[model samples]
Target: MTDLLEQAVLTARNLPAERQDDLARMMLSYAGYDEPVIDLTPEEEADLIEAQAEMERGEFATDAEVEAVLSKFRP
Candidate 1:
């Protein structure tokens, strides 16, 4: 391993277990592993289905609407 990566692993080893797990998850995601699948609640599933129907019907937000929402986060 490169010196930088070795140093990072050594530092990670000293972190709390929860932090270590978070780091491991982040590294796995960065390495292109798909996140674990989660079962959605009934309400969430219904919402997703409705969203898909809206997308199929071209009822999604316009580009201007999207930019307007994003602008709220800009400095």
Candidate 2:
């Protein structure tokens, strides 16, 4: 098999039983076999809710702050 395929098989084999299905699904979706499924757990849902609340409360940086952050990566 190709190096990439061999690596994928090895990585999948190392995942926990619960995670192997997720990994397989992701690989299938990446290869265009199916739409990606997002069966989020409770913690993920809570994090999304908290992020939305923060946005609504204006808990964000200013334009200058954003630019300063992006400047670090600019060539």
Candidate 3:
């Protein structure tokens, strides 16, 4: 029961239901208290590392690539 967390809960209480849920999810994610595991094999890990290196080198898609994916699921 940290003072910061207690204050956050008190603040969230005044939010609308959707906003409250979004805030709760963000808080839990920040705290790393929610456990969702993604298991990857050694080769998959290597592939991911390579991909990340490429991204760091700016060898990646632009904002258009992301928006195209998101547009499909837009409500």
* Local distance difference test, candidate 2: 0.89
Residue lDDT tens for model 3, 1-75 = 999989989998999999999998887777666875567999999999999999899897779998999999999
| Backbone clash count for every predicted candidate, in the order shown | 0, 0, 0
Off by over 4 Å in 1: 1-34
Per-residue lDDT tens digits for candidate 2, residues 1-75, read 899999988988988987999888777887768765677899999999999999999999899999999999999
Can you rank all candidates by lDDT, best first? 1, 3, 2
For each of the candidates, the C-alpha root-mean-square deviation to the true structure, in angstroms, is 12.3, 14.5, 9.0
lDDT scores in order:
0.92, 0.89, 0.89
TM-score of 3: 0.42
TM-score of each: 0.50, 0.41, 0.42
Error of 2 at 11 (Å): 46
- Name every residue pair that clashes in candidate 2: none
lDDT of 3 at 68: 97
Ranked by TM-score, top first:
1, 3, 2
Global CA lDDT computed for model 1: 0.92
User: Where does the lowest 10-residue lDDT sum fall in candidate 3?
Assistant: 30-39
- Top candidate on lDDT is 1
